[model samples]
Target: MTTLQILWFILIAVLWTAYLALEGFGLGAGMLMPFLTKSDRERGAVVKAIGPHWDGNEVWLLTAGGATFAAFPEWYATMFSGMYLALFLLLVALIVRICAIEWRKKINSDQWRARWDWAQSISAWVVPILLGVAFANLVQGMQIAVVKPSDPMTAVPVDQIDLAHDVHNLVGGFWSLITPFTLLGGIVVAALFLSHGALFLNLKLAGDLGDRAAKLAAPLSLASTGLTAVWALWAQFAYGSGQPLAWVPLAIAAVLLIVSTAATVTGKIRPAFWASFAGIAGAVAFIFTNMAPDVMRSAIDPAYSLTLWDASSSYGTLKLMTIVAVILVPIVLAYTVWSYYVFRAKISVDDVHPAGLLKDKIRLGENFLATN
Candidate 1:
């Protein structure tokens, strides 16, 4: 592969890593909202902990998708088009989760808040599970068959061209995406995020809430460590035979997972949170390492796999993208860091308020009608 192609591949991987690390905690916090606190005020505090940064974190997802579409159109086409249904559901879940976060406090009614809270919780759980399943399938390889454009001289229709046995269009149902290994991957990520969220709560809450979160984090971290170990080992044995170096990241991830659990048990919340973040990052690193050169592997025939070289855009395109990314990525990162720094304070029941966008809108409407 050209240097530009390699760079773009790494950049895409980094974007995904950032998304999973940042958004994982947000999702975790959302999932824990109803269970972590009985009082509405406490639950609002949980939402407040992540509210400032959750939207910013989701930008990574958009950037990753845009990067893939620009740098590797074929990979984007095959993956997105092939998994359209699953991705649609994921998008829906994200939308619901975002709405829940924004609208939960719009009214003072218990029933209104409770309805949105359920929406937030369900979507939070669903998004991570979907993402995990998708990642596992990517690692395990999908049934992808690239179709070539028809020759114009022969006047052959693109759809009617005879395809080789090993070459066909993307074909599979939702059931094809799920497997024992993928299910395990979903569990591993879900557990990891749960621990990460609990650790975050420990850091951003005080008093009884903080204590409960820390206690919850300990067991969740332990469970995550075990599940991650199983998933990593299985991936190594199943797919890393040719890529022996992939085991290094797997080992590092395992170590970090262990460290996270230990730190949580020792009541070192920050260390535990960072360890969990590093552990997830390491797991993603291992996956990309194992899949290197090949962007998408075909389970039926290895020869039909999509490699970075085959999937990447032209060198000039990548070079231009590189320039744009270099200019914009740092600015985005700086703003994100500044935002976090400014909002780096623990939230509590006292921080909860009934005022929201809906209230402002209602007042504006009343004023307009009165003036009229």
Candidate 2:
């Protein structure tokens, strides 16, 4: 890979890892809804914990996609085309999940509230699943018809790569999305979010709600750490390397998991949150370490597999976008941190307005606007 390409890849990896960590907290938070909150009032607390920042967290995912498209067009095309169906469903789920939060207050009716609850629940649940699936696919590597130099954009002349006929391809595909590895990732993520929700709730809510959330946090966190360790090892092996290089991420993952669990068990909420974040962050680090160079590796022919250099956009395009990103990324990070600080607090039953003050701000004159 060219220096520019490597730099772009590194930057994209960092952005994606941050996105996973940042948005992942909210995902973990949301997934805790069914288990953590009992009533509309407590549920409101749950919503309030993430309500202030969830939208912004979502932008990272968009940014990551944009970066991918800019830095690695070939990889983008191959992934989107091969996984179009999965991506479509994920998009729909995300839409519904975001909409549910806004529509919840349109009416005060119990049924309306209940509908919102379902939306919240689904959003929380489906997002992590989609992420896990996507990661699984990343590890599995899809079948993409290699484009020859001249035929790169020749329309329908290229054949699509198929996973069904190849044992290695099929194994990789199943391994990517369906294995114990990714599912463990799913579970660990769920628990991490739940713990994050608890911390968010403890900071934002009070009375029975906060106490109950706190009670659930430690156990959820511990379980998640355990699952993460197991899956990290499996993922390392699955990615290849019979030698000890595979153990690097596994050891890092284990340490993070252990530290996260210990911190949570001791009731150090923020530390626990950070530690859990560390665990997930370590996993992302491992992903890069294991899958570097190739955005997508081929099970069929190693020669045909796409590498960072092969899959990337032109150097000019990458340099242009990289310059732009260097300016924008810090600003994005600053605002994200500022917003989180501004909104950080324990949400209460009383915090739930039929129309919350922050609600209008989120909508900006849209249908979900709060009266304020």
Worst 10 residues of 2 by lDDT: 166-175
Kindly list the per-residue Cα lDDT of model 2 for residues 1-372, writing each as its tens digit. 789988887777677778778777666666777777777776766776777777898887888788888888877877776566667878987888788777776666656777787787877788777677677556644443454334442222225533233111122222234555556666656666666566656556777887776788788777776666666666666764245654676578678768767876787777777776666777776766666767876655564566787677888998898788889889998998999888866567877766434432454546744455
What are the per-residue Cα lDDT tens digits for candidate 1 across 1-372? Answer: 788998899899999999999999999988887778888778778888898999999999999999999999878977887678989999999999999999888767667777888899999999989898888888888766545544211222334544332223355456778899888888888888899999988898877887888889988888889888888788778866386788888889888889889989998889989999998899888889888878887675666577888788888899999999999999999998999899988777787786544533465435544643
Q: What are the models' TM-scores? A: 0.91, 0.83
Which sections of candidate 1 miss by over 4 Å?
A: 148-168, 356-372
lDDT of each: 0.83, 0.68
Backbone clash count, each prediction separately: 0, 11
Q: Which candidate number maximizes TM-score?
A: 1
